[model samples]
Target: MKKKHHRVALFAATGVAALLAPAALRAQESGAIQLEQIDVSGGPAQARTAGATAEKGAVGPIDARQLLPADLQTFAGSASRVSSQDLANQRPLTTHDALRNVPGAATVSDDGYGRHSGISLRGSPFRRSRKVLVMEDGVPINFSTYLDAGTHYTPPMDRLESIDVLKGPLVNYGPLNNHGVVNFRNLSPFGPKETVFSAGVGSTEGADQRVNNTRHAHTRQTFDNVGVVLSYSGLNAGGSWDAERLGYDDFYGALGIRGDNQDLTVSGGYFRQRDRYDEDNFSGTLADFKKYRHDKKRAAEAGHFPVSCGRCYEWNTYNADYFRAQVAHNLHIDSKTTLSTRIYGNHHDRARFYVSDDSDNPPSDFVMEGRDRLYRNYGADSRIEFADLPLFGGVTHTVQAGLRYEEHFFDNKNRLGSTNERLDFGNRGSLDGKQKLTAQSFAGFAQTAIQITPTFSVVPGVRLERYKISFRDFDEPGNDGHSTYVQALPMLSFAWEVAPTTTLYGGYHRGLSPHIVRDVLDTDTGYIAPKKEIGDNLQIGVRTKAVRGLTFDGAYFHSDIRNYQFGEAFQSNLGDRVFSSLDKARFDGVELSARLDSRAFTNSPWNVYGEGVYTFVNSKIVRGTADGGVNVAGNEVPESMKHTANLTLGVEHDSGLDASLSWTYRGSFYTDALNLPMNPLDVEEGKVKGVWLLSARASYKVTKELTAWVSGQNLTNEFYVSDRSDGAKPGVGRTVMGGLTLKFH
Candidate 1:
């Protein structure tokens, strides 16, 4: 490892030297070239042509281009904005933690570290994740089975460069855009002149220790026109709660080749996590305890009775590997047309382990415990575009179309242990089981934006999708079902420059999401069915540089979900079985944001920027059934917070130093779906309350070759629970981390 590190360092230094030598010679000949003059709020060309507008608008109004990563967007569009900086400010370790500030969004967790976090969008709960498409660089990451479970096991946060979240049915991108879409773009190859390395360690609850290390290097001359980036991270921590301990490791790398007018990029990565934790039983109610106090005491003394010995421990593990490759060709089909095409493929594998045990001792008799599962996916995608259409009003239009194909496989196994002499029971036969699932889907979509006027435009688009599924099991007779679904998702949006510094926009769209095998499969009865989801979304917003050194954007949105999916507990002689069904829901919300950027803050060392956001949401289950009974007509949805807010202030200096402070708040919420009184014995209900968190970070450059930074999260040491299924367990506490970076160039 030491030798490899040394070689990488040497190669980085050599590449940097090669780039600087030529630039230094050119600088000596030029002698102090002048700097370009332009407005900071808008691009150079726009600033030069719209000087009046620039003066009217804020000094540095939020730029849409800045909201997205440098290489991701094709053109500056609407002001709906969120950025990587915002995510970093939140210090999110899971996707649920990251979406806390977004409107109409909430998260539920069955385990920490994203092991089983479920995302609810626009009031839809427990629906097949296929309803919400997840993509990496325009390629679908959800397997052919159309489920988001992969995220719980193989979260891509460690390798993400940025995340772009689009709310509502966004058909323009492709099929499977029903509830919404989250697009994750990976970090690109760095320049030859840069190298970065960092390491940090911290402690959590229950004597848990967390440590991580990362390295990034950009080489410009490794293969004439090639550049590469490699990164690796490992995390291990003991549980803050009894019997909770977990560890994970991840690796990622990318290589790219740049030609005079074209680019090719290839990347691959892997992640693994192992966890062990105790499970708590929810049936130990206070009434039962009061009634059985005497019996419980006697049982405890004898050590033979189960005093709610809800003390079962569990072990879980997950592993995943993925590979992707993309190529882009820039060409001029003719003097009037320019075209670009991107083609890519992805492959992923996953495995999981689960174990449960009761009391301090293994069962004296035959014990039932352990489960194992495996999954794999493969897919390919392509996109092509034609620009500069010669037609009505000298308009320019872009048409995009693509196709995707995927396959999935799954396997499951169960284990039972032999009985002990004390139980006088014989060993039970072990059960080996396996199941396979396969699915195929195809979609084609197109959109056109016509320049109706110099300052106005209209975009109209539609998409068509067809899908099928098949299943087989080796252990028992497997069931298979096939259904064809077609949806015409239509969208129309308009943008008008009301004034040089202001813009107004509004649009309505139709969206669809397909159900997953889990949603349709009956684990207890071996029954299968197909489910579909649809919704209508409407939004209106205005953005403007209302004053000097300030920019403001706000919007109001309403989404009505039809045939939404929710869980129903079925009572049987054996036990209770949970199943998925269609339910109606409505989600309405308002979002507002403001940003200030100025160099006028008391002669600060660097530019100063401040931002704030507030969101109000109302979510409810309009119609549904639970446990074979009608649901209340006006019940609020579980895990939906009424209000959320965020604020941040920061400064970045030219001297390679930066600092910032951020605060976040979430309103109180009810944990149960029925909204009934929580069991008195359940500590989780009693612990519910609103929460506030504060964090601060700063970094300083020691020299051109070295840098160091420190961050203090949850500075106030606030104790709060992010979620509680039955009883309350506090979320993470105050954490502090410090790290140093070394640059080879």
Candidate 2:
């Protein structure tokens, strides 16, 4: 039944695209629309070309209005961008690797492929990146941003054109924007004809002798007014421990049509993964980490490396299937007015098979338990931009307004089975629990940039959001519950051009985050619907390029968070997670990013460059209650690292040879609100020690069509623990990968 429903939604999205193409073709007969001119700061000139028409006299075309500005320097917010060149130089193995350069982002890897990882920003706790808003080409990607905003899937780095991180006053984004927003810009379908293929393989240092392979193929072509793009990325890898493996496949395609005054783009993708890498089975205690930190062979022999039990690895598994489709259209009403609209839908299915491991049960005991979860959503967003408006004397205003509608559906079921049975609905044992949840939202926002003076601007925006959430428990009819929420979020910002090459910016915004469905409405004793999370955020930043060969950016920010949420692990059964609401917290931080190239000062063939990102934050609970009814008002928030930094140095020659090295550091942080020094029994309450990793990459262009590269991560072979949410999860050891790419027209 679920598969049938998925096909219907997929077909419906495709049908919408099919209908829009004919209308776009008919618009070709209309008169040409006057083009508007705007200057873009950096990156490729035709970065976002699918739904955009080239301006008459602009440096580059405008973005699709995906919340952030095309010119990052003029925006009155703190923003960080990673370009295609950076990706090429780094040769990252996962999405987290590509995001290492972004300041204020704390990335934790629980799986070798980054399929299950954590990304925390500001003072947000790192748990599958629930606090951050993640998007792909301006569309929200989380299964349910309001009900359950957890990261289950992230687009492979192979298909990304660029990455943008935005902070401060994001009125155009959503309820999960309390920390910030991360956007992955996809490659444009309307590009020059070309085909590219790459393949790579690597091995990590361990007694298990695990190896991993990666492959990617991308091709695109333009035929007059029509263009099409197709791409695929695949990965097969070994996990961090013995008897575990991971594999995934991703497929994507796009069709674009261009008219005289309008453009339309339709894109779709399917991703699937099956793995035996369960965090519960992969994690161990602190004593186990210390014993096996350096020697995998001895630890394996001791039967305590992963766990004392021997049969845990064979029975744990995870699987996921995700599908998404989107249609985007842009209309040039006039030279100074335009409209952009996007309709998108996605379906995701996930299953995890796990079992109990205790002292009473034997290692070979077959009592299997699992959870099957399904999430689907459909949304439509439309916005209009009015540029170069003469609103008042000596003042020009650029106004933007938009409306959005979204509906989400989530279904979860718990089952128990024998060891011989698979995770099939009929084959799996009896159903222990069943739930169906839904969320519907209606939102509208408007923002205006008032250029009162040639070198100064002020932007004010507000968003009104209305949402309804429903929960139903099939097992227990009395547990059914529903709630409705209405919120008004406001934002104000200003940018002043202190110098021709420098800009000073500041912003203030009110943020909101709704409660997750399970925490608010569940079959638990003494259940109380917790208040929604709210925050008041303020930030001041500066961007400067006054130095001939350097660019610098710095920002200071503060956030007063109310009703902060924390996830407590191992509170009941082993590896189980429970969410609790704390009273209030405060976060203060400073972010810095800078880059310099020696070639800018010296006209030489070799360009020596350096880039760095550093962040310092202090997160403390001003008023809160910890577990056991303890008053922990002055404790530090869990997983709030005080300092994080990444630095890179590289040299590039005109002959297409480049080499770079990067060093990343993460500061120590507490694991619970009680601020315990250590707890050997639970192993989830303690201060996690800090660690540093070093990576290096070198590439050479052997010919016009062939390029080769090699990279190494964790060159020092550090023995460190990356996370302790469930238990002590060790970080990846030293790894070396090499690949070759062939490109041709």
Candidate 3:
């Protein structure tokens, strides 16, 4: 380990020792207490689940067929959880690998570092992860949901307690509820007061033996009433085939406290990372990709590390600061009714400096671009849940209603090089233009769970939202616009207990995705602004634990998309052109997942799990354009994948040794609405080929406080392509990493 990392680790470890000593001494004085242990082999089949870590509920852990309030569990929809222990074991270097198990999710990275990773859900556009609602403990992280939602800030997964994934029409949640929700919940301060720490060092190697090293350290402490968690992670890495040198330094710190009836938490993060845009596809003709298949290092290697190498400097730097404060209070108001109120404020500042990619005129004087942006969002939310409400027609009802007021402001400044060409970016560029947006939103929602019988329940929900936006263009005052949209979203769902261990659920809801300032404002050409995206979502699924030791959740989903538009490259038998936006698409998909614990079934310490998602997009262009492009009806949807799946099988011993093998498949996706190459000058395949990879991990617990683990990624070293939009960026190559974990409780 480098001295830099050692200093970081030592600093955190010293704090841990200082805190734990006193806590341990006091516990000993008061008589030590320990958690109960469930012996898997000696108990009945049902007892196996007592300590088993499987799916998690919104507030607590849950069993497969258990019943919970809609707010406490995912009802009439699909959801999943990944625990903190799982993240520690994998030590995933990229966000794509961290979310691989989530069905109907596809991730693309310009570089393996996940600096600006894009997460596409159910055929959402593969741009910045704009469509998905990203929240840390239900608080927004990006700038503005409707002004500048696209982002470059993602908290490292290592600091999370668990990740909650909900896929469906979240009619009960406001803001961007159309696509889906992926909430990364941070660890809270509760239970025993102690400290936990994890540190690791590893490396990844490509087919030609090129390697990139990685190092990370995490520490968390829980005092009696106050808790603190600090994390510092750094990565010095390079790409497999692209050879893009990258460096990253991220710091996160949060202070939280819990009381009997009130809890307050505050957290903030800062990071600076060098981005390596591997635009190798723009290097040469199609034959170049095939000729240098094994050894292909392109323009990305020019300016990342510098070292006096005056190759057209393309170094891109991104910096961001994130801070959020949340306060919550619970009032009993009686034994059967409770009122919970939460208020939070979030502030973000981000900037990106880089050379814009010009595929048509590469190797010439490139355009230097600077993107500076600001985002501020604050909101207050209050909800009251009645455990027992008035009954109607001999049915029981548990109702909850909430009101929220949210406000946000955003600013974007773009600067371009003076001559459309620049060698050194030290010279300030010309201000191309600036855009500003102000938004205010008020929302209220009510939902009720009516238990018709002991075995069946029905839920109905409704939400009213009033949103207004003001957009101003600095250069063109005439292009300024003010838009206000008021609408009501509704949902109806049902759950039936078909058997003791099987529950069937289905729901239908109207999902809405709000439009941002860029998508809502008119251009200088008098172009009509695109409307917000809407989807009528329907889903049906069954969660079963009928078979002892086996848990399965299978579902079928369909989304009717309307008025959703995005930039797309289109090419048919006719000439090729890139449209500003494409519209009117539909997506249909199905997912199946299962998990098994062998100990419950055969008295053996083994487990197996797998999940698969297949989405079919019947996308078409309902509107036409005067531009000579393929926006005609019946055209294929751009950047939509037909199939994607993941499977895993693993085994764990009672003595704490475990091993797992996983495989992921990404199907070929079209790059244009016409489903053909967009390069009319040289017609080629427009689809980025599918990629298949195998990953394996093995870990052994040598003692109560020490564990060793090793991870293998892309073991087969498969030569595959990931994205073909601007250029072909290849998939991650083969790599191996190992590390140790230390814990004291």
Candidate 4:
């Protein structure tokens, strides 16, 4: 009977959303970096082909890391970006690897392959990146972000042109942009039939680490008014743990039609991956981990996990597929007013097969636990911008407004498996329990930049959002209800261009987040009654080119977070993993950074360059955990890094030779809210210590179209822990790779 209800609900929601949704409306400049000669008034250019670069003026684009501070826009707060050049310079292989230059971003990689990444901002919990809005271009990358928000998939960096990281929601972006927004901008399509191809292989000195290969290709074509672009990236490699492996492939395709007064872009993506998840650990005591901290001779001598001896070599297998589509249109309404509309849909399926170490049970019996999760969502995001308006002063107001309407669905089945036929609902493999959750949202926002003076501007914005969700538990017919959330957020900020090359910025905003649906144990309270989180974000910063060769951006922020949420892991009645919630917390931090190019100070083709970022976070438990005995009001929040710093120094010669060295440091952090040590030295697998990693790279251009490079990570062979959960997760050790690329123009 419940199955019948689930099908009906899912079909109805999907049908309506599909019919009305078009794709993401990528206005020319909502929050993207502006390329030289491109009209900043226009949103992302539709005329540009996919994978095209700014060098061609057709919108391929560059990253933030490639821009000088003088080129950055004067927003209320700092927005950081990483360019394709920076990515290539570092020879990145994972999402985290590509983002290594961004400040204040903490990528807590459980295992170094980046199958599962923890990106936290302002000291938010590192799991699932619940506080950050991760997007591709202008569309949400995760299906039903409010439902199962995890790092299920991250588009390969090789096919991307730039990545933009903004704090809070942009006026044109849909809803739920409280903490931060990270958007992966793909390479735009270039016209005249252009193709770009590249490939490389890497090896790491760690247990089970193997030589991995990464390949990517992009092509663009234009015929009269229509343009098309297709790009793909694939990876075949070993997981960062013992006896593990991984495979991933993804593609992005788009079609654009440019007209005299209007333009349209339709884009789609599909991603697939298979990974081995090994959780073999000793988890015994501090002394035990100490014995293996420097042991790289082989896979550890032994493990203390609760699994059979022979079966201990096993682990879970994860498989996932994600699909997304978007249609964006821009209308230049007589130059002064422009309209942009985007309709998008995303659907995904993920499953994990559990393998146990039970000697008494047969291999077939060991695979009795499994998880299947599904998500579907479609919506329209619309925005209209008035380039210049008559407000307090003539031609001084740049105003914009947007609206979003979306429908979403989530379904999951985790049970004792009776057969290998999983994921599909057919027979459902001895379903122990099932849940079908659905939601719909309507959001609206408006903002205007009031130029109070030639060198100063005040921007004020507001976003209103409302959502209704239905939660149904198939096992218990009565355990279901409707959860509703509504929020009106207001923001005001100012940017003062005090000098020719300096801008002072500051802002205060009210933040809002929907009441999330949690997968909790039956014993957990407020499972269905989770409340929406609310907080205040305040920041002040500066962007300046004070010296001929030096540029810097710095900021300090404070947040009074209220009714926030934290997950507490627990075992359910069926021995399944579940999470309950912790009610309130507070996070505040400081971020500082600087960049330099010697050409400005000394007119020479032989140049020196340097950049660095440092962050300090002070997070605390305000309302404490749900458990009655624990009073953690004054303690530091779990996994809140005390300090993090990164620096890079390099030299570039006119001869086409470049070399750079980078250092990354992370301060110690507690594993849990208890603020207690798990090791005899006051730290253990559950309490992570500080870490420092060194990296270096050099590349030489044989010709303008061909380049050769060599790179190394953890060059010092540093030994450190990344994650200290049930067991320790080691950081990526020394790795070296050499590759050559040839580009035909």
Q: What's the TM-score of each model vs. the native?
A: 0.76, 0.90, 0.81, 0.86
Q: Give the TM-score (vs. native) of candidate 2.
A: 0.90
lDDT per residue as tens, model 3, 256-353:
56544333456666665555443334333455554454344332343221121224333545555566666543333433344545566677766666
For candidate 2, the clash count comes to: 0
Better of 1 and 4 by TM-score: 4
Weakest lDDT window of 10 consecutive positions for candidate 1 = 22-31
For each of the candidates, the C-alpha root-mean-square deviation to the true structure, in angstroms, is 9.8, 5.4, 9.3, 6.2
User: Backbone clash tally for model 3?
Assistant: 0
- Name the 10 consecutive residues with the lowest summed lDDT in model 3: 22-31
Which model is ahead, 1 or 4, in terms of lDDT? 4
Looking at model 2, the pairs that clash are none
Q: Alpha-carbon error at 279 in model 1, in Å? A: 6.8
Assess each prediction's global lDDT (C-alpha) against the native.
Answer: 0.49, 0.74, 0.59, 0.64
> How does candidate 1 fare on TM-score?
0.76
In model 1, how large is the Cα lDDT of residue 53?
A: 14
Specify the highest-TM-score model's number.
2
**For each predicted model, how many residue pairs clash, with residues at least 3 apart or on different chains?**
3, 0, 0, 25
lDDT value for model 3: 0.59
Q: What is the Cα-based lDDT of residue 302 in candidate 3? A: 35
